[model samples]
Target: MAYQQPALPYADNALEPHISAKTIGFHYGKHHAAYVNNYNNLVAGTPFDSMSIEEVICATAGDAQKIGVFNNGAQAWNHSFYWNCLSANGGGKPSGELAAKIDGDFGSFDKFVEELKAAAATQFGSGWAWLVLDNGTLKVVKTGNAQTPLTSGQTPLLCVDVWEHAYYLDYQNRRPDYVAATIENLLNWTFAEENYQSAK
Candidate 1:
């Protein structure tokens, strides 16, 4: 099972106005594909080659000999999920079960936004910010380059990539602006809700 790049859930232009098509094109096409390719090559002819991408990532994550594979595989999976976390029509507050969970865990939806933004903004370097479910409780997590909550056995409900490649084209050096806009306008709460429920 060689790692294969998943197609974007929507067209590159589908996220336009918030995230430009050109940005998505390069991010998904060049950056993400390179990771997938690297993962496949690194694991070629190894036992890990037959494992699913997620399985390989989890299995090799702590093995020093497989560090490169773990990084590439996890990064490939993370990028795929991150792209799906946005939509042109997405954004706004979450509703229903996800909304209830946010209120239950974060005191209120607004507080959740504040904390999420803070996490994304203060990550200090290239990484990711995520809303993850751990034992049915929601929490904000920050991961360094290629790291993922999956490595720690948490279920990621929604995520924003803070890697420079993700926003450099559209947001330039303004990562905070990108984070604010993403949380306010491009979040796919429906997808987050689905992931939240499924994690149970």
Candidate 2:
């Protein structure tokens, strides 16, 4: 089946102040949609034509010759996941098992935020910072453009896209400001919890 662009979990204007509708419009409607469209084209006449996005990502991972396939497919998957990672009335902190896991793994939610902030801020260029389940252990990891945890053994719980396109229209060159706002106001901990339960 040809991959399609997934809709944003919330309305485009849902996350205001923290993430404006204009940002979402160009980011999701344009940037993410482009990846979805490109992925479909790249896989149209190849083995990936019938494979799931995850399968294409895994199959092309680390194969330099298939970098285009990897880039488009992984970016499609990543943006889908990224959209679910945000919410209008989300963030603050989690409760239940997810809370315990965060505290246990990172000492405190503050520390986890600190770590995630550092990851996104220090990523150097376009990339992502993630909180993932690695060997049943909660961990934070970051990857460069089009790289995703799906190709790695870890299971991603939450992610923040630090690509300039993700925040340039809103926060401009201050990537840290965008990262901080997304973490504090847009993070969907409930979605993270759901991903965690499935990971285990």
Candidate 3:
């Protein structure tokens, strides 16, 4: 089956001032849609054409000859997950088991925030910062370009896309500001909690 871009969990303007509707229009309607289109095109009539997105990502992850397939497939999957990582009512600290895991893994929720913010800010180029389960422990990880934890055996609970296109129009050169707003005002902890429980 061909890959299709998933609809946003909320309306285009739901994220409001934290993320502009204009940004969502371009980001989701254009950029993400392009990735899905590109992936479908790249995989059509090939062995990957019949595989799931995760299967394609893992299969093509380190093959230099398949970089296009990996990049597009991963980006398509990543953006789909990233949208669910935001919510109109998101942000602040998570609660319950996921919250307890954060404290246990990173010392405190504040420290986890500090680490996640640092990972997102210091990623250096287009990429993502993620909260993931690695060997049953929660860890903060950053991946460059279309790289994702799925290719590395980790279960991604949540992610922030730090690609320039993700925030360029909204915050211009202030990537840090964009990252902070996303972490503080837009992260969907409920989504993260669901992922955490499923992974466990």
Best by TM-score: 3
TM-scores for every predicted model:
0.97, 0.98, 0.99
lDDT of 1 by residue, 25-139 (tens): 8899999999999988998998987888878888988898888989989999999899879988899998898898899999999999999999998998889999999887899
Local accuracy by lDDT, each model: 0.90, 0.92, 0.95
User: Candidate 2, after superposition: displacement of residue 131 in Å?
Assistant: 0.5
Poorest lDDT segment (10 consecutive residues) of candidate 3: 3-12
Comparing 1 and 3 by TM-score, which wins?
Answer: 3
Measured over all alpha carbons after superposition, the RMSD of each candidate to the real structure, in angstroms, is 1.0, 0.7, 0.6
Q: List candidate 2 segments past 4 Å from native.
A: none
lDDT of 2 at 173: 97
